[model samples]
Target: MQRAQRNSLRLLQWMMAASLALPVALFVIAATISYTSTNDIADREIERTLDVAHEHALKVFETIDRSLAELNEVVRNLSDDTIRAREPALHRRLKRLTDSLPQLKSAWIFDADGKALVNSLASPPPALSFTDRDYFYSHIDQSIGTFIGMPLTPRPPYQGARFFSVSRRRDSDDGNFIGVIQASVLPEYFESFYARIGSDPGSFFAMGRADGAVLAHFPRLNHDLRLDPGGPVGQQIAGQPERGLMTIAWPSDGIERRIGYRRIAEYPIYVSAGLETSAIRARWFATMGQHLVFGIPATALLFLLLAFAFRRTQHLQAEAAARREAEDALKHSQRLEALGQLTGGVAHDFNNLLTVIRASVDLLNRPQLTEERRQRYITAIADAVARAAKLTSQLLAFARRQTLKPEVFDVGQRMQSLHDMLATLLGPAIEIVTRLSAEPCLVNADAGQFETALINMATNARDAMQGKGRVIFEVETATTIPDTPAPVSGNQGFVRVTVRDTGIGIPAARLGRIFEPFFTTKQVGHGTGLGLSQVFGFARQSGGEVTVTSEVGQGSTFSLYLPRVPPDLRSQRLAPNTAPAVAGSGMSVLVVEDNIELANFAADGLTELGYNITLVDNATDALAELIVDANRFDVVLSDVVMPGMTGLDLAQAVRDRGIGVPVVLTTGYSQALSQDGAAGFDLVQKPYSIEELSRVLHRAARLRRVRDGAAE
Candidate 1:
């Protein structure tokens, strides 16, 4: 009987081993499949995006080449003196052509002396000598067809926009180089197009010249950025010359990527697209994790049933692991809570704005409203729109996109002016105090952003104090800052502004992360956590620093340090232009709007402004009307966001077809306008008053007449 029992035990041991081995083998096989599949998906996606980048690069360069050729042909036979004499007309022509192409930043024609004779950016190009420029030097030596040069910022007097030159050598009849006809192509244009197509995390798209000059890159633009010709991408081009794929660590950032590169057809330009290897591996891990979630639990269950001998030991281990998992889950939940708070806070603010707009519209629709009440409702609607715009602006500021309009101002005086406003904002429960410097505390910065930052700090103080505390605004000159805590004595060139609050201070653990976006100690409904981040970004962007010191339950002090400017350098602020609107005297307008009601509203408004109006519901119809008689309308007023084609497309069509009418675009908001910026056409923002619309339309109409007169 003992021998029989031993046999049964051995049989049970074999069954337990089989159960464990089978599931383990299946799990390994499944994981292998998932990893391979994920890598394949990543490869396909990278190659597809590369193909798109390649096509876009090709199209852009080809258009630029065509523009250069046309420009060359126009000026090929003209002498320098003759070109200079005809520069006014040629300047207009260049502007017209350059505006039609969104990729072109500006166009220029240079004399043999390397002096710009005409440019699209201005009526007469700035009298800057370009003899030292690489583009000019490249053509001065030889005729290389279209020479693609490295990116550069235009010299002073020009707005600092980075551009890569696509230039053709202008030759005399005897094959001697005369000058260069150059088109400055915006790298941001290519980056914007790449962004629209979308990208995964760590995905990269770049357009570069064969000579290692990086013309454009997504995520950032640097005029001095370049690629090494000896790198993997370049070596692949050398071996393949047309197109190929490889895996390499990017020399610029040391990131391992699976890269696909293509050389533009017979041109000295190459485009590369890459997907991060780490991202690919992460995807593979995620897929396998899902499988393991189920597979491991099932395997555990099978093991417990088959091996009663080890069941108690496994149970104890699982209980210990469960407690560890609970801790990890709690940490993960805390992180998710911050994201939930941000989303809820943004939604709440936007909803409040929407509520005001909706209620105001309802009130305005009521019958027999008094003119004063109507104006009040209209004003309320306008205020809501402005507030919503400001909210978005703050978000953009935190994202580091807010364009600062810096000017010299006295920080002390500005703070003094805001004393009453601060008291009102903080409420009667909170006492407001100011300790401004008796002397001037002048600084060059964006006054609006500074005010916003101050308000953010004040509101944070109010929240910290639970709406009952003392808030102090102090401005003074500092010889040293936190960054240079012990500067030499009397080196006083920094203006320091402090906002100190008597309130419950921040915890040491959380203080370091206060400036991070979406991280806040406040409850979910109380804050969006973007205010402090905006303040941080504005400080950094303005060439300053903001530092805070806090002790738990002992109040907090926030200090901002900005470089002080001399009193003599304080800039004069421009007053608002409040001139009366110019009436349209029988001018004809073609109004294109997708919304029927809006189209009628605009037509009626223009008609009341003494203009003849023809309305259409889409860009296609507007183009048809222009095609029938482009000269009939003095200005074409169109909504930017439209069906079948955008108002931008309509404007381009008008220009491309040599139509003489001026196109004025209107929009509340549009991605196209934000990206390419009206493409040199006049733009009037929506929610415009009738007077404002009349002024814009009249201005465009006047330009049309002037152009016609110039032609005559």
Candidate 2:
């Protein structure tokens, strides 16, 4: 009987092992199939999404191009004075042109001095200046048939509002330059077109210039949709468009999305489509859940049968191990919470110091100092400001507050650009080696921030090397693998930027805390402990991931896996220096500032610069003065942040009351204002010197005077 029992027990043990092994084997097979199916679905969905987005984007571009062509034709016809000389014929043609194309807001002609001669929107053509307009200056000398300009805020006779212009030079019968025939397209036209693009709910689209200046958006995501060059998607879009899919984490929803972007063929604009992983995962999860539900019951029955016949000692051991792991995870969470509290406090205090330094530097640029003394003071102030800027940059990097401007460029080229600067920054102790990829591998990132990140990484590497070891910078395109320490996005393809150093390797204990702000291994004064944190923050912010591999005796390698900028977007650079002129003369001005110190400073500066100044403490006071003498203030210069009324409110009120004063808003927190509001008012960023203030005020005054003069 005892021998029989032993035989049964042995047989039961074999059955139990087979049952457990079969379920696990089945599970592995099912998971593999599910993963493969999910990926296939994702691929198909991505392709479809891209196709739809591409089509819609092309449609919008084609419409604009068509509108431009029509305007060009009108300009060509209007160039002949014989045709324009017949007032009734010209008026009828202009009305018919505007009626034929609803998108065309108004058509007009401007002489050499920017005086408006004829306009479709005006009864009797109102006189106006085009000298300050982007379209006027940008395309004034175009030898072509027609030139389309970037969108601008319209002024005079037409009412101040945003509009895109198409201009063509008028020529006499002998081909001598006479004037320009221009057409203005309203913002509403673009808005209507965008609305018809059929975007899904929770999805938005924007059209912007290569420089990140937003031209239009569908359903308008923000009041001002200026693509922050420092923002993740903006940085990614900054690259060439041909390279294909660029995966990034969407900051709005904190979801990993695969973005396929393409730049407009002829224009300096990009169109991108974002596909959420969760959307793809939904189908995969359902398939997996259905498979699991069907298999779980059968597996449970098999387990029960085996359990009845077998010893249960092994099940207890696995449960005990899981419990220990759970406890460890709970402990780690507690530690993270504690560390977060500590970091938050430090960051708050650091910000205050930066603000004070920035303010002090602005105060130092007063005009009272002699040229020699001013230059010396300016140099010192600039140096201090730069250091403070770096500090704020680091803080923003750590906090993920800094926006990214992603662009596509050769890794080698970028590295070469920084070669001398890096060498200077690192000093002679560290030997730098570059192993850049021969094929230009494009990375989508803010060039400035990316350079800063690279410098920070190099600095850390140099420190690790103890000023006497080799620091190698390497670039290569790579594919990621699952079940490995890779970026959280789960993207297969990436551009790897590796910074390896032969130095004192990080200890196991310190490795985990290396990315924590202010968690330094070095002496208190030697470091702020923000370098690695900034690097980590930058990587995460850029829709990429970073990892460090090191050994106690050997050196360390910091690998940054950034999303590759597609091949097509690699050539798109920000619009080259198109700075607006600061010259404006012979104009009356109104300076409204609550701060007596700043107001008086600005007023005195404007008065010296030959501008008639009317100073007020609030927007209401300015409004009262304007109402009493409607034609007194040619330009209203008001503080953005004010006690009684804001600059925006003041400007709106002025417009509402039909007071035609061109508003130039000033603010210390220019960065904080909405882009639309900033664009609406010709803004002068604060902490401005008397000269800087004078220049802006003079320009604003001139523009206002010109507009008012045209009205009269």
Best by lDDT: 1
Those runs of model 1 whose alpha carbons end farther than 4 Å from true positions after fitting are 1-5, 221-223, 308-712
- The 10-residue segment of model 2 with minimum total lDDT is 575-584
The CA lDDT at 572 in model 2 is 51
Candidate 1: worst-modelled 10 consecutive residues by lDDT: 483-492
* TM-score for candidate 1, residues paired by index: 0.42
Model 2 C-alpha lDDT per residue in residues 206-253, reported as the tens digit of each score: 455666666665554334455567787766665654425656775444
Clash count list over all predictions: 0, 24
Q: What count of clashes does model 1 give?
A: 0
- The lDDT of each candidate is 0.82, 0.68
The TM-score leader among the candidates is: 1
Alpha-carbon TM-score of each model against the true structure: 0.42, 0.41
lDDT of 1 by residue, 103-150 (tens): 998999998899998998887677889988888888888777788888
